[model samples]
Each structure stands twice: as structure tokens, then as C-alpha cells.
Target: MSLSLFDEPKLDSHCHVLDPARFPYAPDVAYRPAGQEQGTLAQYLQVMDAYGIRQSLLVGPNSGYGLDNRCLLDALQQHPDRFRGIAVVRNDTPREELQRLREAGVVGVAFNATLLGTEFYANTDPLLRHLADLDMFVQVQVEHDQLVALRPLLERNGARILIDHCGRPAPGGGLDQPGFQALLALARTGRTAVKLSGYQKFSTQPPPHADAQVFVRALLDAFTLDACFWASDWPFLKAPHRLDMGPLIRQVEQLLPDPADRARLWWETPRRWLGF
Candidate 1:
């Protein structure tokens, strides 16, 4: 039998499980995710089942939790078979702690240069080296011209890297923009991968995000199908408007019309990279 779009097996390469009630938001955070921005593990699982997602790569957000990875760890421990995680940690965090996180099902650490700015991660070389030694990924979220500043640091470490949100390209920044071009250039490095997601974060147009398609095509051509993965930035943090998973799934169908290509981007690539 042929499969429907939602019925096709998928691994959500990006999403979050925020249980402020159980884990509590950090006191120092400038903004706390409330209401729909929050999606607990139980809730996320229901969404997964609803959408035919086999697993998810849970990312720890810096907004409400800061360095507190307890919520993410709790979810990973509780549902070890269903999810892996990307964490948020301080630059000075010790190797021992990273090892502990690795043992706990964390696959990488996130560097949110978009939310915190490139300057904040200037001292991350040691951390990057630690990740390289550990064979873990350095997942980055940077926007606009920010990537130009961090390219040297990211390339030198040789840690396997995952980029978030199509580099969160700056609005009207076209194909030749320095930051997006920098992202495409990373494709030559062979150790890099990008989450083909977050159109709402970067696109000037809504939903179908027609303008962002060019960037997607450029990335697919640059990184090749094997190195690209599909992601829905679920319960999308700091979003300017409400969004739903259904439309995102439909968007993927439109993005890659061929069943064979969708199979690679949606399931095969992530399964190989994350061992799902």
C-alpha cells in the first residue's frame, strides 16, 4: 500500500519538550515560555503519534531554562527509546559533565548565536574541541551576518555540526547574502548538516513561505540529499504567530514532491545520523 504524507515514518529532527511545571523555568531568564509555547513530553508524544513521527530530536531551549537541562534529561530518561536530545550548556562546563550528558542520551550541545549573539560564544573554542573529542555535534542557531563571524571557530574544531532553521536567514537576504552563502559554503566541509526548517522564523511570506524555497533548493544542491534532514520547529519558540504541525507536514510534501526524495530527507538521513 502507498503511504499518505502523515502516515510516512518520520523523525522530527527538531522540537522541544518544555515542562516548566516539573522542571521550572530559570529565575534569570529574560522571557519564559508560557501557554502554547510549552509542549511537555506527554503532549509531544501525542503529537508524534498523531503525525506518524517515529522519534524526535529534542532540543533544550535557552529561553526558559538557561543551563538547566533537567527537563530535557528527564524526558530522555523517561522515553529513552523515543527521543534524543541537543542540550544547552555553559561554555565553561566541564568535560565530565558533557560525558554524563552523553551517557544520558544527549547527542550534542546547542550554540544559540541567534538568541545570544555571536559575541557571546566567542570563548567556545575549548567547548568545540571537547565536542570534537567526544564525537558529538555542535548544533548552532545563528541569523543574518552572524554566521560569518563564527565560521572560523566552527570549522577549526572539526566537530560534527548541525545547523538549525535554514541558518535563520535574514529577511530579504536573497541567495547571495553573506550569512546564507556562508551556510552553503559549509556544505563543502562534509561534517556539516542543516535542519530544513523554521521558515516562519525567517520568511517574509507566511505558511508556504514561497521566497524561502530558493534557499532550500540551494542547500539541497550544496549539501546533497544525504546530508539534509527535515525538521518542524514545534511549539515554535518566540514565534510571531500561532502555528500547527499539520501545515508543516503539508509544507514538506510541497517542498519535496518526489516520494523517494521525501523518504531520504524525512527518515533515512536522520536515522543514519541520529541512529533512530
Candidate 2:
């Protein structure tokens, strides 16, 4: 396999893996992945090896498993050096359980406000504080508009915040949009890190995602390189078109051609944030 040419160790900061045959979807699964081929841990490792990715953050497929983290925990246990996890957990989940997840190599907990609503946070404030106390990252997946309102609340309760999918910015909003601007401001605080990921999820244009570059540049200018991270959002779940990991990796290189910038985006930032 041809390894990455970049100087620093690479990490895909966001990806999900699941095998429905072994770990079936929750009864109330919000949505099922459209693809016939679900991502498996073994499959992800094959790609990681080919691309020279030294580590990865395996985010729980929340829609598939609900609050159950067995799939993600298993991956971490089997390959502790190569993987860390972000699990989906409920408000009432006990402290002992959270500690168990931490021992199992889960470094963060994810909440999908787009599906769960803001009240989810209201109910989970205690859990959020517990996560913060444990020094674990709090991952929030919400649309651009939610940032303005959510930022203050998160600042007060969350230890560190990871905004998923580039804040799910609206097309053509660019830097002027209040929500996007708020997201950039949050990044300026250094406590909030934005995943330079899920381009296909937010872009109006197709892959290689040229349209999203303008906003990304603005984020780099505002957030600084250390607060930004790059990820594959692999298996391309729910994306409009199929995307291969090779092109996605190349896209970051094209976006940040300077070796130093590429190293930060692909390695340093994620390594620090995810504790890899």
C-alpha cells in the first residue's frame, strides 16, 4: 500500500463503524444508513493502513445503536493504540457507566441536537458537567443557527466543545451569516474546536467541495490552525453522492498545501484534541 506523504502522523478525526448483522440498529433508530455495505472496524483499519493513518476517533453510530456503545467500546478495547471513541449517551446514564466508558477508551460523548432538540441539554446538564469534570470532550452536532444560542450555555457547562461538520453551515452564507460568524467567534475562544469535516453534508456544490472552501478559509483565519481539525466522516453516510477516502484526503492537501498547515490540519490538532 502507498502510505501518506505528509511528515506528521495522520489521524482521521471523525469516522463511524458498525456491523448491523452483529449489532443491530436500535428499535427507535432515527434513521438507517442507506448503503448496503455498513462500515466495519476491520474495513476501516484496512483503509487506515493503506493511507498511513496512525490513529482514528471512532464516533458511535448514534442513530444505529442509540445509547448502547458496545460496538465502539469493542473497537477501542481491541485496538487501544489505534482508536478512541465518542459515544452517544443519555441524560440519566449513571456516573459509574460513564467511568466505565472512559476506561474503555471513550474520550468524548456526542449529542445530536438536530434530532434530540435543545431540551436534551436541559435534561443532561448534570451529565454534561460530569463529562466536563472527567475532562472528556463534549461533542455537539447542531446546525449553524444553534451556535449563537448554545454557545453561552456550553461555555458555562462544557469543559471543551467540538462542533461537528463545520457547524453545518448554510450554503452561500459565507462569513456574513450570523450563525457562521458566531461559530468562528466560538473557535476564537480556543475552547471550541471545529471539525473540518462532513463537507458533503453542508456543501451546495459537489465533491472536492470547492464552494465550502471560502468559509473554511474564513474559519482558519478566525479559528487559527490549532483550533481546527480535519476528518473524513467516512463511509459517507447519508451523503448525496458516494465519496472515496482517497479524494477526501487529497482535498485537504489541496486546501492547505503548505506542509506545516497540512500537518496541523491532519495531525497536530486532532492529536491534541482527541488525546491521541
lDDT string for model 2 (1-276, tens) is 533464346888889987777777788887777564378888899988877688998999776788878888889999999999999987787878888899899988897877776766776767878888888888888776777777777777866888888888887776788778778778656678888888887788888888988878887887788888888888777888778888887787788878778888888888988887
Each candidate: RMSD: 1.0, 2.2
lDDT of 1: 0.90
Candidate 1, residue 152: lDDT: 95
**True-structure RMSD for candidate 1:** 1.0
Residue pair clashes in candidate 1: none
TM-scores of all predicted structures:
0.98, 0.93
- The TM-score obtained by model 1 is 0.98
Off by over 4 Å in 2: 1-8, 34-37
**Shift in Å, residue 161, candidate 2:** 0.7
What is the C-alpha lDDT profile of model 1 across 169-252, one tens digit per residue?
Answer: 888878899999999999999899999999888888876788888888889999988999899988898887668999989988
Model 2 scores a C-alpha lDDT of 0.81
